[model samples]
Structures are given as structure tokens and as C-alpha cells.
Target: MTLLTIFSQSGKYLLLSIFAFLLISCSESSPPALTTTADSIYFGGTIITLNDAQPSAEAVAIKDGKIIAVGRYADIEKSHKSAETRLIDLHGKTLIPGFIDGHSHFSEVGAQTVLANLLPPPDGSVKNIADLQKTMRDFIATSPIVKKHGVAIGMNYDDSQLAEHRHPTRHDLDAISTELPIMVSHQSGHFGALNSKALEKVGITADSIAPDGGVIRREADGKTPNGVLEENAFFGVVYKMFPAFTPDEIAAQLQASEKIYLANGFTTIQDGKTTKDNLKLLMAMSEAGTLKADVVSYPDIVTFGDDPLLQSPLMSRHYKNHLRMGGVKLTLDGSPQGKTGWFTVPYFKVPEGQPETYAGYPAFSDEKLNEWILLAYKNNWQVLGHCSGDAAVEQFINAVRNAQKIYPGTNHRPVIIHGHFIRADQVPAIKELGIFVSAFPLHTFNWGDWHRESVVGPERAENISPTGWFLTQDVPFSIHSDAPVIFPDSMKLIGTAVNRTTRSGYVLGAEHRLEPLAALKAMTLSAAYQHFEEATKGSIEVGKLADFVVLAENPLTKTRANLKQIRVLETIKEGKSVYRSTEDEK
Candidate 1:
């Protein structure tokens, strides 16, 4: 053969090989063809999948409440389009996975809806002591709850935000009602104040001694009950004085709470630290098909460890009628802002009536904590421990470490809820132990100044929540609202996590602030993973639940300042519109 002829043959063979390679590459990159028509197709605007494989998508198709396809709008439309399919035009809105609750008392949020709003400035109008008293009085006169329940209840009153910077005493609540039994909860829900009538009704008196892990503030004489209760002391009065709700009343509260969560773009809600009665009520509500959004209750195992109800069929991973038992909740300590969180170092400023060297105290002995955690491990149950202070965090870590040694091969996925004050050094151990942290960065905006000035001082205040540390250590963490402690405002939660801005407009923990996308993941994918629902929920992946929120602005594209202002235009759950902004109707 001639040399020119041989060269020509080789060149032709190389060209054919290149063509074959290109064809295979294109085929591999192309989206798979859809086999069935979608029940609904969402397209236009931004779709953040939170799926690493496909970080963004042009369209999503859903059928029977499960995602069927996610890819380019053209591909999805061409393959999955049908006359009966619902085409949801985003109109330039941003779609994201519906938020899952990190940790919050869902039913208590329902109860808050009925109580007088005492949260400071943004969430409510009670900014000072006078405002608190006046609000309680107004609620007494106007609220049907007061008349029906025969008691006045107010929630979210922050001593830190009050004009006087002190807890409202029985004297202050008495100003609102001398005849009526009145109680006002500190914003942390770890402390409370009761009028003389309510205190007397609850059987607390000068002779009453505080519980092991709680305090009842006393008058100057050191013997008179001042009606300001803390931790266990406050909880005891709550159980005694709070009116019993009929099943119907409890259902109404749950309905109201679910609406608030839905309006805030949360699809999965956590009713953390649930009581036996409350759990039964929730189960009844589920059976009655009254729940619209998914609720996962972690009953107070400390109180009902022996209750046969803990072994119910409802304790599975699957939801039945929008409700399921996630696991158990254990409170290891109280709130930092309330000055009750267990800490190794002394608080910047001790609470009134406390010693100068006060560093707070634990909810129970370490032995008890270890015992409970080991029990959870033995049962292979996921346990969520509320540890807001470093000392409490240490106790939890030690307990978990011991439990793991005993029950070594199981994937219990024990969680540290509200590790708000965990030390930087502890992050490594947390990562090693696989302890998921559901932090409360919302505290930064709500009480960052208070923490700096009065709680833990400037240096330590900057580390509250410490999401940045978790990120640096490669520890899995999620952010939460701990609702009823504050409103479950998802935008505010995201904004605070991103900005770490105090109410005074100062960025308290600038270094600890998360990027917008990371903050969103803490509430979505990370949160779902925390709850072991990552496989079915969290992202807009095929076979996942069709749960999403439509935002007025894309968080990824917006300036940090504008993030909190982004509105939830619509919330969809299980391929259905659960909440639509009234503005959308316009």
C-alpha cells in the first residue's frame, strides 16, 4: 500500500473513534427519559435541589406525593407532560426544600397562639415591664381564653429586653390582676412569674422549698416566696397551675400551631419534650386525621420511660396520618439567657439572689444522665439532649461516650439539641461521636446583646451557637427556632444564621455566621438528616417527598441584608398547597 493511503486510513479511524467517544459522553450527560406522566410539573424561576449530584434544576415533576423527575424544564416537559398534569409556574420565584424543624415544642407553639404575646419588639409589642403588665391586663379583659380557662397566661416575656432588665415579680403581675390568677413566662421558658393568687393556688408559699434542679426566688427577708420561679421550680408550678385542656381544645391548639409552622414554610415539625398526656393527644389527633403537616414528637422519656405507650406502633420511622413518634427528648440544662444553663465558668453577671460565683447547674446528676442515655442506646432509640451550656454539653458527651462503649455497633444517632454554649474544643469530640447538633442561632439576634452584657460576657457571647466551628470541624449541625421561645419565623432564623446580628444591629458572631446556602441546608437537608429522613425528604430528588417552599427572592442571589425580608410566597406538602401568601391572591 502507498504511504499516503496508509495515513489516510489511520486518520479516518481516529475520526470515527473521536465521534464514538463524543456520542457516549452526550448520552451519559443527557437526562433519563420519563416513563410516566407527572401529576404536577413545577418550572420557571430557580429550583435549588440541595442535591450535590444536581445542585440546581430547571423543573421538578411530582406524582402521588413523590418527586418523579428533576432536570431541565424542556426535558421534563417533553417527556412527562400530559393534559391532566398541573403546570405550576413559579413566576420567577425561588423553590427550595421545605424546612424541617431542628428542635421545637410544636404543641407549645399552639398554646402560645392562645396566650398573650410578650415577646420583645419584632415579634410582639412588649418591650418593657409596663408594656408586659399592660399586655397581660389587656389579654385578661379581651381574650376568651382567660374567661374560659379561668386564668391569665402570658408567654415570651424577656427580662433582658424589659426596660428594667429584671424579671417581673409577683408584685408586677399583681399590678395586672390582684383578683385573677396570672402567670407570665420568661422568653426562655425556663423562668416565670406568678401573681400571689396564682402562687397561692399552686400551693407555693414561704414554706415551700425549691426543687433539686430549680429555684424559687425569695424576697429580701430570704423566706418570702417572690413568685419568680426557675427551671424545675417553674416547671412544677406550670404543671400545677396550667389549666387542663379538653381533647377538643388541645386539637384546636395543634391546628393553630400547625398553621403557624406551615405559614413559616416548615413541613416537618418537632414537638420536643412532649408529655405523656400531650403524646396521647397528638396520637388521637393523628388518628382523627386532623394534622395537616407532619409532626414528630419526642416524648419526655425521663418522665415516661416505663410507659407502655413508648412501644406503640406510632414510634416507627414512617408517618401515619401526618404524625409519628421520632424518639425521646432529655433536657440536660436550662436556657443560657435565663441564667439557668449549666456552665463550667461563672456567668458574666449572676442573676439576682444568686451567688457572685454562680455558674448555673444541671437539670439532673451526671449519673442519672448517663443512665438515661445508656437506656436509649440499649433500646437503639435516637435521643435528643438539650444541652445549652458547656457543662451540660460535657455531661452529655461523657454520657454518650459511655453509652457507645456499652452499645457499640448501633447507629442510634444521638443528638445534642441546643448546644448553644458548647466550647470550641468540644466540636472535635462531637464530630468523632457522631453527635448531631441542632443549634439555636436565633438567640444571636434575640439575645446576643444580653448574652454579651449580662449572661456570659463579650468574649464567650461571640461563640454562642458556633456554627462556624462545627463547619470547620466537619461536624454535622442544624439550626432551629425552638419556637414559642420565639416565633418560628423561618426567614428570621435563616437571616440570623447568616448574619449573627444582634437586636441592637451588631453582628455578634461575625466569624460564626454561616453562608446563606449553608444556613438553608441547616434547616433543610441537614435537619432532615438529623431526623433520619434525609433519604425521603430534604432535597428535590426523585423518589423524595414533594415538600417545598416558594420564596419571593432567591436566597443564593440576594444580599445578606435582604435575606430576612425574603417572603415565603407558597408552601407545598405532599404535592398540595398547604399555605399560599394572601399577597399571592392579589
Candidate 2:
């Protein structure tokens, strides 16, 4: 009963009192227990959430094709761990939100794969008109589908890179084959050349006048059509000229096309421009369960006009088979690189047969454009207009302004596509009018020199796709590769947007170059916003779609020179793997 006994008794009493207090406090209020388990846990990699709020995460948990949690591996695992959960080891790779191309013609990707490659250097090697003819001839000889269909089709023919320094006319295509109808599309997809047979098949004659908002280039005699068609004319004839594929063939073609997009890490792809017939085919493919990624299309005004399906309630925000019609598209002019985009100034050097005082012209009159725009506005349809030149952009601004007067107080999220020639002054008008731009920045790399020397002159060329201007003016914009014009490579898009470097090692618009992280956001969050799907997609947030792409290296860490070299290892959509590279296959 000395000091040792007294100390021991006092310590035991203190421990018992503290324990009793803790038990009483726990009994008063208990925290909720974790009840839901994740279906899969991905860790051991650099996970870029692309969500500015959280920014980055060490791990992600997914359940039912949605992100359940994103944070430190230990914390997320503690809450979502279960016996049935699948553990995904990233193997030291990098993960990002699945890319959403700002603008593209995804349906045409199938045709591009099956058709002859007529693109110039970097994508294909057609250096001149002679090379183009030979490429088509070789393709026709080897393709049983072309022979069976009795039509030879080729795509991505760029005049800017051709040795002849001119567009290949129908006369040029006729050299490839007069017996079978031959059609070669300009790389821009805004113009096309058809052989005599194709012209006759479409009923174009020396006396045939071009449709409004379209042009039928004629020979020196001013009577015989040269076989080159622009803008609306391209759609009118080519839409009917190509041999129709059966439902099974279309489904197969679409699946093959989606494989290419998936391989490039595009989870949400746009067809950009579609016809009612093409929409039907897409719908059929969607219903047949052949679609591998989300598709958002904007039908051309000509194709969307007066259609019962488009006018129905189902047309607004309607989704089927992972496909949705974002809105109506209007081609205000043609391609700037193709020399048909409307401009306020004359080209430094006009095309071979053109007038000396000519500037490019618009597809349709303002009155007609306004009518179509007002129709879309009144119907609450999102309008996506292609305006490659500043003049064309002005046309869009005026049309939208007038439409707003008729249908006031609505934020419809109207968009301007390929506003490559947008100037600093026009940026204010675009923002004031509450319009968004989806610009084609790839032109800087592929045709910067040509635009400077010939298309728009050095003054205007320096400002093409002026993204810096947009940022300064606080305007919303996104960058894109008008696919099939350029390969739909997301890495290339980000690289081009960040570096603004041409193939010949020249900086086109150094001021317009975006930061690597900002460029990535353009292809993800901004692209999703352009299609009005920002809340449900774009970022790796909780309750959002589990779409992601695994990269070999982190884009933010990769040097600008090595950006394009970064390969996509895998593409995931809805928590399901849609594409795996050869490296993964091994």
C-alpha cells in the first residue's frame, strides 16, 4: 500500500473514465457506414481528371458505367473495397478524359478507309494530278467493292499540296477512267471533282446553272462545266452519286469507321454534316448495336428541311443507339484552303481560271440564310454554321443577330464552325451575340504557308484560328481537325493547338498557341460544351460517364516536339474497353 499501489490505481481510474466518455460520445452520434462497393478500381498511374475542381487523382472507382469516386488510392479503396471489385493496374501509364472532337465527319471515316487515299504529304503522298490519277487507278483495280458498285471513289485530295498548284477538275479524273464514274473529294469536303460519267449521272450539262449557295465551275468557254463543284453543289451531286450500301454493309462500315476513331481516343465523335438518308443508316446501325462510341450529328439545312422526323418532338435532344442530333448545320461558304471560302479581300493569286478582282463568294444570299436560321431559332434548334472566312463569319453574325430579334431572350448555344479567318475585331461581335466557335486550327500546320502566300495573304494568314484573340476577349472556343481533311489524331490536334507549327518548321501563329493543359481542355470539356453535353460528359467527375483514354505518356509532361509521338494505349467508353493498341494486345 505504498506509492506504487496508489499510482497504479489512479492511472487505471483515469483510463476507465476516458474510455467511458468516448463510448458515450460514439453512442450519441455515429457516422454513416460505406454501403456501396465499386465494380472496378484503377490505380498506379497518372490520372488527369480534367476537372478543375479536383484537377488530379491517384485512383478512380467505377460502378455501372459511371465514376463512383476519385482521390488518393488508400482513401478511395477504403470506401469502395469489396471482394467482387476488379483491380486495374495501369502499369505506369497516364489516363485522361476520353477526347471529344470539336468537329468532324465521322460517318465519312468509313468511306475514307474503303476509298483511295488522295491526300498529300504527311497523310498520303499524292504530289500532283498525275499521282492522284495513278492512286485512283490502282485503288479501282484492287478494290472489288468499287468494281461491284461500278463507281471509283477517292477522298482527301488537297490542291494546296499538289505539284500542279491547282484543283483536279473532272477532266483530270476522267483520265483515270471514263467508263466508270469517278469522284474525288477535295480534302476540305467542301468541294469535289466528278468525271464525265458522274457528271452525266447527276444530270449536269453545259447549260446547267449552279444551285443557290453553290458553284459549278465552267470551262474557258463559259458553257461546259469543268466538273468541279463547290459547297452546296458538292452535297447535292455527291450525296446522290455514291453507290448506296446495304444495311449490313453500312453497319460493318460504321463499325470499321468507329474503330479508327476509338484508336485515336475519340469517345464522342461528330459526323459534322449528315443527310436524312445517312441519319437513317446511322439509326439502323445504332439499333443493331454496332455503334462503339457516342455520335452527335448536325444535319445540313437541305437535308433537315421539312422532314417529319426532324420536325417531331423526338428531334430535340433525342438520343438513340448512343447517337444524338445536336442540331442543324449550314455551310455558309466553302474551304479557305480550297480557295472557295468567302473573303473580304481578293486572293494574292487567284485560281488558274478565275477573275483578277475576285474574292471568294458565299454559298447563299443573306435573305435565304436568315430564313433558315430563323427557322432553327424559332424551333429551339442549335445551329452550327461553317464559316471559314471572315466574310462568311460576318454573314453568320448578321443572321444570328436577326434571328435573335425574332426569337429573343434565349441562349440556344449557336456555333460557328471552322472560323479560321476570324479577326480580332470580330471576336467582340461573336461574344456579344453569345455565339461559340469550334475552329479548325490544323490548317495552320497543313496550309499555313499556302494561306500566307496565296489564300488570304500574309496579313490575314497570321490570324487564322485566332484562339489567343478569343481568350483575350473572354469568348468560348474549341479546336478541331476537320477529319478526313486531317487524320482524327487527338495528340496531333493538341500538339498543333499548342505549338502552331507547320510541317516545314515554321510558327504560323505563335501568339495563338495555347498552353498544353488548355489545349487538352479544348478537346475535352470545351468540345463537350459545344455539343450541349457538358454536364453528363467531358470530365472525370462523380456521377459522370466512365469514358477515358490511357496514354503512353502524360501530355502535360511531354515536350512540345514529342507531343504527337505520344500514343493512345487504350480507349474506354462507359467503363468498357472499345479500343486496345497492338502494344496492349501483346
Candidate 3:
């Protein structure tokens, strides 16, 4: 063969060898392609992603409880085209991220189901003391659940709404049951009333001194505790009164409570004030695989002081089987509506027993609060503080500032709960302190009229919650129901945030009203962020959990007045329907 012919043959072999080497390298080094098949594809609904990058989508593809793709319906349909994929038609509904309750008492909300509901208007029609007594009597007569137990309990009784315009005392509760120990919890859960029998049964007598940060209201003699217990005092006694529920009983209550939350579109809910017993119960429920929605609890820091459980590495944000112990919960003060919240100014209509100069007292002193804050900081624990009054807000701000100075980190994400009376001046400080505010906007509607006229005076009451102030300050804030204080009604909550209207139809803090989308964020992405589960749970983004709520209408397009009217058609958790409304579309 000629030289040219030999060279051509060599080139062919060399090229072939190079091609073979390239193929081998590609096969060995490249990552395997991700599975494109999806378990479900939701379409034909207006999807509010709550994701800034892609705020709206027509379709979402989910697989193994995660969002795999979100885009136009045609695009998702074309890519995941297959017969096995379950297609969900929204039926002209609107879908948004599953709500995350910023702060609430999950267990308490469930307990309300079994307890006599003494709530005033809207939730229950307890017009006066007589109505409350009658309700309790009726429950006692009818409920086998309560009748089976030795003691009797009723919940969510609000004095402010009573026609008598006062708290139900032992005399009132005695009307329900003097034979069996009877107790009625104030709507705020910061105060409660016990009958003479209950007071005696619990060993609280005239000789018993009030515990620190609590009060046992006295009679004219200044010796008799007239059945009223405030703050720590009430909690201490009531906790002991709780019957030992079996694990199954506890699980059943949890499921019942979660149903309410799920109906309102919450994927993650919180128990804002948990005790040691509650912690154990929650852990048991978690271990038993009974919790349906994600639950994050915050045990009372004062009660759990220096406990090994609080100090455990396990307590630092552990989520398993949809249950987590987020951190410690502290009460700087009590509830404003209950007139026990520490405030800078005196209440407009002070109770009969209180001095005109009496401002509600703090649950802990500045030094004690500082110590607790330091403990949380040192242990790298998130703190959720209940601070409804301005004074309490100030104390919280100082404690947080001091804590950060000692151990600084922007990622602490410590939260201020309630903030019902958060002052305009304090708004900037909250922003500067880098803390999150979970305001009780539901207070605006449930008790706004009463607050303006009775609790805090019109001027201060108008500014209650102050969501818009947080917005202007560019601080992270979200709206909450403080459930059992009010229902975990997300539509009602967002509507109240947007409307700031009271039950009496008065526009309160109109300036403080949030925009529709902003209100939605408070319940969705913003709330998830407060709980430190934003990345995994909040918003309808790819790779996030397939958790969403199907609404009858898009909140953004609806009129402000109609926001609350937008019903939750269905609540989807991990692409499975957890709640579906039985009522016809309104």
C-alpha cells in the first residue's frame, strides 16, 4: 500500500478509539437523570405560588410528596404526559400555599371541643353571665365526655363580651356546679374562674398566697380568693386538674384539633404555651404516629427551667413524623383583653378589684427575663415571648437586645407573640432588634369594639396589633388567631388583617390594615418563616412540599369585604386531601 493509504487507515482507527473513550467517560462520570414521572398533576386552578420568582402558575406536578414542576398547564401536561399521573381539577378554584399558624395553642383548641364553649357572639352566643352559666349547665347535662370525668370544665369565656360587663366569679360558676368542681377558662386563657368546690378541691384557700407573677383575687375581706386566678396561678391549678388521658385519648384530641386547623388550610400549627406534661404528651403523640399535620410546640420556659429536656440537643428544632419541639415559650405578661397584660398606661375601665393606677403586671421581672433570654441565647434556642402590652413589649425588646449583645447572631429568629398593644414607637425597635412579630390580628375583629370602648381606650385600641406599622418598618410580622381565643379561621384572620374592622362594624386602625397579598403572606410564607420551616413548607415552589389550600376565589381579585367570604374548598397536605368542605359553594 502507498504511504497516503496507510495514513488514512491509521486516522480511521484513531478516530474510532477516541469516540469509544468519549462514550466511556460520559457513561462513568455523568449523574443519572432525575425521574420525570409524577404521581399527580394539579391543573385548571389559579395557583398563587407565593413564590416571588413565579408568583402564579397554572399547573403543579408533585411526586413523593414534593413539587417536581410548576408552570403553565400545557407545559407540565406535555412534559409529564402519562396515564398513571393523577390529574386533579380545581374546578375553577384558587390554590395557595398551605397556611402556617404563627402562634396558637393547638392542644387548648382541641380541649375546647370537649369543654363547654362559653365564647361570646359569632363562635357562641353567651350574651351574659346567665347565658354562660346555662351553656355550662347544658354541657354538663348533655356531654358524656365531660360527665364521665370527675370534674367539669368550660372554656373561652370572655368577661368583656358579657352583658353583665364583668368576669364570672365563683358565685357564677357555682350556679353551674357546686357539687362537682367546676372551672371556666377566660377567653384569653390567661385567667380562669373556679367554683367554691373547685377552689377547695384544688387546695387554694384564703391562706394560700399568690405565686409570683400571678394573683388569686380577694373578696371585700382581702382574704378570700373569689375563684379568680390570673396568669401563673390559674395555669398551675388548672394543669393539676387535667385528668390523666390515655395516649389514645390524647391522640384523638390532637386529631380533632388538627381537623379545625386543616379545615382552615394550615399545614403547620403551633402550641404556643406548652408545659412539661404537654411536652411529654406531644412527644408521645409524635412517637405514636398520631399527628397528621406538622406540629411545633414551645414549652413554657419558666416551668421548664434548667430541665434536661429544654437543654437537650433534641429540643433545637427537631422535626420527625411531622412533629417538632421548636423552642421555649415565655410570657412577659398576660393577655390584654383579660386586663392582666402589663401595660405602660392604666386600663380605661379598670376592674372592681384593681386600683385606678394599676397597670397589668409582668409575669417575670426584668432581671428574670434577662436571665431567661440569656439562657436561650447561650443554648442556641429560639424564644417565643408573649408580649401584648407596650410595657411587656419594651421588656421583651430590652431582653432581646441584651441577649444579642452577649451572644449575637442575626439568625436567632426569636419571636414576639401577641403584640396586641405594640406601640408605634416600638415598631422601629422591633425591626432594629431583628426579631419576628406574630401579632394577634384576630383580636381586631373578635374584641376590637370592646377593646376600643373598654379594654385599652379607643386611641390605644385602634393601634392594636399594628400590622401596617410592621410593614412600614419593613419588619417581619404575621397575623395569628391565638386559637381558642378565637377560631383558627384563616379567611377571617386575613380579612381582619385587611379590613381591621370590628364585630360592631367599626373600622379600627384603618391605616394599619394590610393589603390582600400581604395578609395572605402573613398566614403562608411569612408564618412558615417565623417557624423556621420556610424552605421546606412555605409557598408552592419546586422541591417544596406539596401542601396547599384550595379556595373558592382568588383573594387578590376579591373585594376587601369579600375576603372573609372566600371559603376554603379543600386543604391538601402532601398532595392528599385532608379537608374538603361539605357546604355548597357560596
| Candidate 1 structure quality by residue, lDDT tens digits, 1-586 | 8656766877888878999999999999999864889999999989999998999999999999999999999999988989999999998889999999999999899888888899888788987899988898888889988888899998999888888889989998888878989998888889989999999899999999898889989999998988899998998778677777788887888889999999999999999989877888998888888887899999888788858787788887889999888889998899899889999999999986679989999999988888889878876678999998999999999999999888887767889999989998898889889999999998998889999999999999999999999998889888899998978999989998998888789898888999998999999999999999999999999999999999999999899987989999889999999999998424
Which wins on TM-score, candidate 2 or candidate 3? 2
What are the per-residue Cα lDDT tens digits for candidate 2 across 120-220?
Answer: 98789899999999999899999977977888888988888999887788888888888899898988888899999999999999989888778898988
User: Which segments of model 1 are wrong by more than 4 Å?
Assistant: 1-34, 584-586
In model 3, the runs with Cα more than 4 Å from the true position are 1-35, 312-314, 584-586
With a 3 Å backbone cut-off (N, CA, C), the pairs that clash in candidate 2 are 213-363
Report the Cα lDDT for residue 4, model 2.
Answer: 58
lDDT of 3 by residue, 1-586 (tens): 8656766877878978999999999998998755588899999979999999999999999988899999998888877758899999888899999999998999888777777888887889898999988888888888876666777788888888888777889988887778988888888888989999999988999999998899999888999988999998998898767656666676677778999999899988999877666678788877787677888888888878889987654475647877778888898889888888899999998877679988899988899999999988888789999998999999999999999888865457889998889888888888888899998888888889889988889988889888888888799988888888889899998998999888889999988899999998888888888988888878999989999999999999999998998889898888888899999774
TM-scores for every candidate against the unseen true structure: 0.93, 0.93, 0.92
TM match of model 2 to true structure? 0.93
Measured on C-alpha atoms, candidate 3 has an lDDT of 0.86
Cα RMSD of all models vs. native, in order, equals: 5.3, 6.4, 4.6
Per-candidate count of clashing residue pairs (backbone under 3 Å): 0, 1, 0
The TM-score of candidate 1 is 0.93
What does the lDDT come to for candidate 2? Answer: 0.87
Candidate 1: the clashing residue pairs are: none
